[model samples]
Target chain A: MRLIFMIAVLAAGLLYTFYAFNTLNFLSASGRLGPGFFPQILGLGIVSMTLISVITEARRMRATTNYFAAPADAFPGSALLIICMSVLYLIGLRLFGAIPGSIVFLLAMFWMISRGKPILNTVIAVMAPVLIYLLFRQLLSASMPEGLIPLPF
Target chain B: MEIFSDLMMGMSVALHPANLLYLLVGAFVGMTIGVIPGFGPAAGIALLLPVTFGMDPVGAVMMLSAIYYGAMYGGSITAILINTPGDAGSVASTLDGFPLAQQGRAGPALVMQAVASFTGGTVGVILITLLAPLFSQVARNFGPPEYFLLAIMGMLTLIVMIGGNWRLGVISALIGFALGTVGVDLESGRSRYTFGSAELIGGINFIPVAIGLFGLGELFFAFYSGSHKKRDGEMLTYDGKSNFWPNARDFIETRFTLVRGSIIGFVVGVIPGAGAAIAALIAYSVERSVSPRPENFGKGEMAGLVAPEAANNAASSGAMIPLLTLGIPGSASTAILLAAFLMWGLRPGPLLMEQNPEFAWGLIASMYLGNMALLLISIFAIPVFVLILKVPYRILAPLVVVVCTLGTFSVNSSYMEMYIMLGAGVIGFFMRLYGFSPAAVVLALVLGPLAEESLRQTLTISRGSFGIFITRPASLSIIVVTIALLVLLPLIQLYGQRVRKPKAS
Candidate 1:
């Protein structure tokens, strides 16, 4: 699993490096260092470092007799589910509104984290979003996105 | 006399009734967050950055500084009672603090920690008041070349000393620098990496990224690791019978240790990359080595507790010097503070005194008051902090998520910021899992634009000659030291390995 994460990270770094290099114009006659120059340097450095890390990890895996001896968190399914829910929450808030979206997001997350203490989760999930909306909108005067249901505060 | 007058003016600004209330609130929040196992000063500040966004600059900074020192004071509670270091800086405290607690002397231990923390924090602030002005004078001579070199040196030292793995640190920093370049170019007036998105023109706000990385990322880690699972073991509690204050004799005996640790911690804090954790460890070892009863060290010795508590608190204060005087953050918390400085539209450096004397002096004055408040709060608020720890992370996570979501969105009232935070949180989680330093990324993100602009300006001034970096005296010295550590030190180590291997063969 650790090896997989390393590989994934390396791939992401490489992909980004390639994209940044191709996207940015590194050469400009106006100055020795252009706007793109720093990003390109960073891109190159990331690729090199990721390569080193990947090679090192690969060697370590080969040398180790019991690969599982290395302590790594078992990436819990619940955690992955929570992450996905958060993504949905963000999108929901974007499309609908902070209040309605927060209610649904909070309910699902609270239930998930509490492992189905439905009554407590429901109570918290309902109350927290409203309280947050009031505090942020009324007290702080924060500009929040208005959606299907308009907020008074 | 001049410094005294400046500080007096600073005190007037800091003592504004509203600022005082914010200071108390900051200390309370800092202490509470410090008591929680997975949260520390950095995360707490990041989470609360939004709250300060609408505040007066002086008041906001005073509150944040309070939080920083308060967390240092509050971190010892869990270390002493539960044998869990609430913050990394308090890990050394657990060696003797937990033992003292187990022996049913938790009150004396707690008192010792508070008193030692007070001593260290006061001394550190004193040194800051004296040294920051002197450093400001030196910083006045720095140009683009010098600033560029200083940034490089700061980054290198952070990677070598704190990141623990140079390769991982480099990768993380590079990724951070890349992220920093996401917005429209200030000089060229051309969008570099926006990829045609209107939102990308404003670039990635460091606050959301910070909150997500340090706050939400840690929450994700706590969940997956199941570290929040309630431990079945009993935690040592105060029985209301023990002395809640260390005896006068104990203080009189350990006075020298507290002063020595404070000096060591302050000096280390002033140095880039040597944070409170290292300061505490070094102070602990120094006290252990020099003690007449060295054998009693780490076996519930008073000196052991005093050394780390004093040093870490002092170091937290000391870390402010570099950030305030040079605009170089020595640690993650200072990096966030640096962001705060930028957000408030005040640049911290030599010119800060001239440009924003009120902000600079007011913050320093507030630190003095904040330390006193922290001492009072920590001593009185220990039970409240202990109770807070019992609140399950399950309930806490949702609250944190909601706060962070609102906070991130409040930055620009942009929902896109929330999405960015979620993505950054996931990346930050994996970065932590893979032994990469999140601090490195953050420091890079904060410093990258400065470094890049300086480098470009230096080159532009020198007509594209790279020699400009090495030709200037200050920049040259910094570059030489950076090279020795990054290149020569590793070469020497490899050569030594080869030499020892031949003898073994």
Candidate 2:
């Protein structure tokens, strides 16, 4: 079942990659080297490998107990934390911008990492991101996203 | 004698105060990251790369090189204390490293790692200094066929050698080739894989993927495996004080492991697909099999710690060989290093050695000096690293996560990158659960683009004859080797059983 799923995903990707390559006009011999040649071959490689893996995995399953077993919990609580944190971090970015959102995000993360020390960890996390923001933005002149809380002068 | 004169000149360039300052700063920063849990030398180097973008090519390379060795020295600290390798390369160290700590030999374990790393790195640097020019001269003769062959050879080994289901590994590699196709098709103005998303047109940046997979993926794994028993605590009071120097007998025992590992590291480092972590693992396996007291392994045996550390360090220097010579990056760290070169408006190719001998020679010299510095400082610094670990994981986790996110944000100010990071993090978290090797996926993601570019170029030249790869000697040899490995795996396993049968008897 998992092998099937993998093959399906691989096929989808291959098809998309092939179409993507062909859609762009790559059928020419103009320059020293033409454009579309690399993409098409890459697409084919992806397709061939995907097929090969599926076949091999299927064979292994037939010979042994099975191939590609999904565990009881493919997505666990800890992974959920990552999902929530990432989504929240993205939300923070959209709402606050990279700097201020990162500040809040880092603070919460610090709170998470410390396990029990909330306030102190939050302070360190918040301060670190803010200072990093200031350093990169002000000194390095790299433009960061303008989050809900803009970087204050 | 002539080589001695060049070495002296190289030292002169490396000794400049400006260069020295960067080296110190780089070493200090690199060690800081290395000492921290979860950040390997590659990740450490990636984190520090932004700081060097501002310096001159020579200074930048010097500092980066210093950090490379410094982080190597730092990676062992957490391994000994926590039994958790901060980077994959140091995973072997945990076999004996944490055991030694448990047995109150933490000090010696660390000293072993540092000294071994320095020896390997020093030898690797010497070899690189001698070998790079020779390789580059050979590379100068390379044509389109050679580059094409090199790419094929690179992909072939990756498919055969990396640990995993071989079929799945190939799938991963092919996917990587696809991703490499996403960025502005370098050979042509036409874009592929952009799918009208402007953010992606610049392409899926490999750095963010690397950081997300190694850094964020690891953090996610730690969280997922939170229920796994953590080590009780460090043996803070166990203070056996052996001389920091590894003695002659120690050398006699570990010399073969060190040499074998150095050679493996250098060779692996030169290959784009076979990286340092794999090299270290392979070396450690060899060390285990070869050791007279195999049972002593994973219980803080000196041999276990020495072999992998040496391989990991040598791999660092070895990776530079391909980059400097063939203008190809053997590993992710070197890949990032290559980006720095590009930003400085330097194109690495056949003529690179001829055009930038000073920059090349200076970087190699600095690595030599960096090795000496790492060996000198680590003698006194291991104690301090243990102290750092005692601060508690709870605090360290928060700090590391925060710093990682900030570094992620800084790498590109794009909040979108953070989203990509977040998405990748979530995917990575689940990948760990499903038994997918994050390293495999990450390497696939990292090299996917390169493979795609090479494949596309190969076909463009061949005009539909994919067999053109077989026509080239280098490419054909690599492809043949890959096929042989694919066929020989079961035979090798059978041979292993045959050898072990007598032992079983």
TM per candidate comes to 0.92, 0.84
Output the number of the lDDT-best candidate.
1
Q: Could you list the chain B TM-scores for each candidate?
A: 0.93, 0.85
Put down candidate 2 lDDT per residue, B20-107, tens digits, no spaces.
Answer: 8888778767776787667666667656665565577788878877876687778777777677676766766777778777876676
- What digit string (tens of lDDT, one per residue) describes model 1 on residues B1-505? 9899999999999899999999999988998888877678888888888788778888988888888888888888889988888787898888889888877788888888988998999999899989889999999999999888877777876777643567888878887878888888777776876778899897778988888888888878777776545552346466647777777877887899999999988977776766787778778878877889877766788888999899999999999988998998877788898999788888899989878888899998888888888888877876777677667777777777877887889878887788889988898887887788888888888888888888888888998899887778888887777776666434533442342242234
Best by TM-score: 1
Candidate 1 lDDT over A1-153, as tens digits, reads 567777887787777777667766675765456677887787778878888888988899899887755355554665677678778877777767878788888877766657647887788888988888887788778877675555563
Kept native contacts, fraction for each prediction: 0.66, 0.55
Model 1: per-residue Cα lDDT at residue B424: 83
DockQ of 1: 0.60
Where's the lowest-lDDT run of ten residues in candidate 2 chain B?
B227-236
